[model samples]
Target chain A: MAFISRGFHGRRPSAGTKLPPGQYETTGFPVLSAGPTPRIRQDDWKLSVTTEAGKQHVWDWAGLMALPAESPTVDLHCVTKWSKFGTEWQGVSLDVLLADVETAAEHVLVTSYGGYTTNIPLADLVDGKAWIAYGYGGSDLAPEHGGPARLLVPHLYLWKSAKWVREIELRPSDVPGFWESAGYHNYGDPWREQRYQGD
Target chain B: MARAAIPGRLGDRLRWRTAEVTGRRVESATAVTLTLDLPGWPGHLAGQHVDVRLTAEDGYSTQRSYSIASAPNGRSLDLTVQRTSGGEVSPYLVDELVPGDRLELRGPVGGWFVWRQQQTEPILLVAGGSGLVPLMCMVRAREAAGSRAPFRLLCAARTPSDLLYRSELRQGAPGLDTTYLYSREAPADSPRPPGRIAPEDLVRSGWPPDFEPTCYVCGPTAFVEKTAAYLVLLGHAPERVRTERFG
Candidate 1:
């Protein structure tokens, strides 16, 4: 068969760069969701962290922004194979939010306003690895992009970074969330191309 | 009574199978429909999509998801490709591929947006640009099943020339009503101004709010976002409006 060369859709990483395998860099942000975008009212929005022991911590939209917010520039890789490099987001680190809360949980289930939920290791949420980002590109996050507040877990596939995030429930053991129960890998590390289960 | 089992290769969803291009037809200037013959082809519901992967000689490959344009048939299905400018796979599929060529595909993906023959509610389908692909499948499925479900399609295209399935849509299907909204070029006899589909278009062409039509909106993210929002604002339950965002 002859070589079938096609034009590159976007920029490709230089050698030795850390863009994930089987992924291409896209300058444009792609909106992906299983259902309609939830129209959440800011005045009514709240972020809560609950432990299996019934202890709870809550923060409203204003109170969350009043906390120490930091801007982090990171690359987001989606299981759909699109990666955006050097995207800037502003939010409070999950470490700070969980600092005073006491929990012996090993798993965290992030829930959103739209009834979307995704699970990740409790370790993945703390130690400065995750953020409850409410702003992107220096502006208030748009609702369609999981704005107001979306969990940013830069290391895992974007699906694990649940959009419209509102709550984080700490559990003693891992339970598969929405996509995990469907067919996606539980721990979606784009570097290993862990897209589907058993990958 | 015993239930009929799902036939064909109901195997792993991630597994990619080789499909041969059995037929190709120019759907429009920018689009072509490639008919594929799959090995152990499992039939798909209306509105499902398949991922097509192409490999270069160097082994570099890329995949894109395209909606299945034809209704359930034998082992054959049609994928309509629109030549997206600067797109990696679309240009090749639209202009280069010929009959007898082969590609790897994984699917009948997406169960949410599907239209089943048993569903009796009125359906409101809104398409923006090439987003018409999946909705066309539902229309074709309705025709193939000889079902008389109420279906209204509001196709938003750049111009009359860009409208897909022009002849067939004009010929019409049983109980199907199609309205064309041209953002750039409207026909000389068009009653609508050349503009994007608006809330008024929904009120005028779509079923009334009382009809409780299940709406499926697909297209570029912007179009889907706007159309779905409008449908919900116009009194339809948020749950009734399903959307598929395409770039």
Candidate 2:
């Protein structure tokens, strides 16, 4: 049995508030990164989607802007146990980005500017689920918050939404990325509270 | 690659263990340092964190991540927690918890943010408020290991009274240089005006970027974002500087 501290009662959530197990609601968007924030100029930034067969679909800043954009208000859950609700973001859906690309892969390895990477399932990236978020709160996304562009997978742990994201490599098999290979769960589903490997 | 450097049982599956609160020390008005006794505890590197889980009588449970504040010792470690206003876990840990209390925690969580004794290059540590907790572990670890690596700490706090580890930091150790920047208030004899850390402060108090020193910055999100930006603008390579931001 887990030990319960004496006279300890956590704050009770409101009647309608929805959060993953072990998560507490937070209004602030905390930044967690392994390295310093990369200052990527909008002109120099590019997003690439490469399939297992080696076909590449690359989008420059202007090209990405030309694509139809969606404004999404979603909740974000970090594996560290903070959940921010109803956060607004602006970006193109992954569905739009992958509409023309052909792939039979089931997994994706998201790579960022500073050597950070996280793996996700290809199914989670389509069907209006994920986005390559470039703006937040009606303004250009700040670099500290994965500015220029970052994958926004709100359904999973925020880490799955790799910050400073640059490439999405579709893979036929699951390959753990930086945190995954280290200790974080390979499939970071917040709802399941699958934080660590054994969990 | 960061995991490869972690020593001992930490490389294995991390399991939740019972941590008994052996002692506690008041750090500031809103912060307290907890000394924990964990049986079968594996050693941890400086700057790693632990996930503290607390369950209620009704089986409702929540967890929070806290950085380890003490140097690695057998079967024991310390965590300095700052009470966030309206927070669920911190208030309990800081105000209500006492000696002999037991909690569940799984730990030594981070790899990239750690400081190992083998690192010999000149080190720069920039801390904002409670962010000093992990960096203090590095300082203590350096002292414990008798390492001669040059260490420079630039800590920003609201005032001298808000500073944690004030007395110990005053009792300086060898090969370590300490600089304090007060964002709101400073003592009468302070060298600089009260303000946020600027690029010049990095040049004066931190190792020059050319020194290729490994830099660690930790703090609240805004503080870290600004300080890290200044470090990079001052010429530190993006890869050489590591950061950990707290909510």
Candidate 3:
């Protein structure tokens, strides 16, 4: 049970603007990171997808750019209780990237350049549900906002879209990543208001 | 990779505790510091933050995160709120909330961006705008512990008037060096011209990269990005520099 503060009437979003429970709309994009931003030159960047059977598929910056890209304008919901709608991003769909990869894994541990990691179900990454995004708006994604490329999973909380994403390890069992181990929900679903472990 | 120093169940830390506003102080033109008294508050590190929730009579509610401003002090804590134009919760926190008002807040969040008293290494705190709040807590913590850790603070603000904890910073403590960089306006006796924090400003104010100081950078996204990038360029290890950025 929650208690109401005296005379603390908060801002109620205008009707018809859809937002998840316990979230408010924000015009500006906020940056949340565990540590300093990693500076990876485009030439030195590489992304690898390791399967449960130890099969590895690697893609250099050039290889990533060679793949077809899609422009996705999706809504973002952050566990921090801020939401942004219709954010434009350009990236290669996970379906296209994983089309040739063979995997029978149930989960994936997404890793980034700065040692940041997040876990997600493999089912959530396929079927045009996610992308490896490198561009935001029109230009290259800023380093502060995970430049070069980031995993774009709009269906879940923004943290599910790992920034500066570099590797994906498919595993048989679910293992909590950085934030997940630090008290965030392992399988973050913004619509369900699953921001923490119990919720 | 700093984990939560407080030992307890995650549920307890995330639990919403009722706190009454015991004291209030106007920090700046648009910022105010409220002292909240939580009856069963768990202690938190210097750089941790709290999530504040406000509910209306009609069941509408919203929440915002604010950094802890005061050093660990039993059940009492300080949160400095800056009023952003058209902001939902900040306006109420800065302009409307008063003493004796009760608010629900779940505390001491974010283990990564925290400063523990056990750390005796030199600390470099780079703050912009209201980012000074958490760093100020670290400074106060150092003083409270009587730890002689060398602390250098490089604060960038639009003007001196925009700086929080102005008088407290001016008082100055031993082993703590603070450099003020004003972007818009500078005082008459100010040494440097008014401008944004440049790489050279950090080089002069911050410890040499060779010293291996733990750097804490907090502020707006742009400020934190630029400052952190400059620090890395100056040869500081990326792992040594921790950041907490706000929109």
Global lDDT for candidate 3?
0.89
The lDDT per prediction is: 0.84, 0.89, 0.89
* Tens digits of lDDT, candidate 2, B1-76: 1322324443366788998999999999999999999999888889989999888888888889999999989999
Identify the superior model by TM-score, candidate 1 or candidate 2. Answer: 2
Which regions of candidate 2 are displaced past 4 Å? B1-11
Query: lDDT tens digits, residues B204-244, model 3?
Result: 88999999999999999889988988998999988899988
Per-prediction TM-score? 0.91, 0.95, 0.95
Model 2 chain B worst lDDT run, 10 consecutive residues? B1-10
Which of candidates 1 and 3 reaches a greater DockQ? 3
What are the clashing pairs of model 3? none
**Cα lDDT for residue A168, model 3?**
93
For residues A132-167, could you state the per-residue lDDT of candidate 2 as single tens digits?
A: 999999999989899988999999898899888899
**Colliding residue pairs in candidate 1:** none
By DockQ, rank the candidates, best first: 3, 2, 1
What share of the reference contacts survives in each candidate? 0.18, 0.53, 0.60
Model 3 clash number: 0
How much does candidate 3 score in TM-score?
0.95
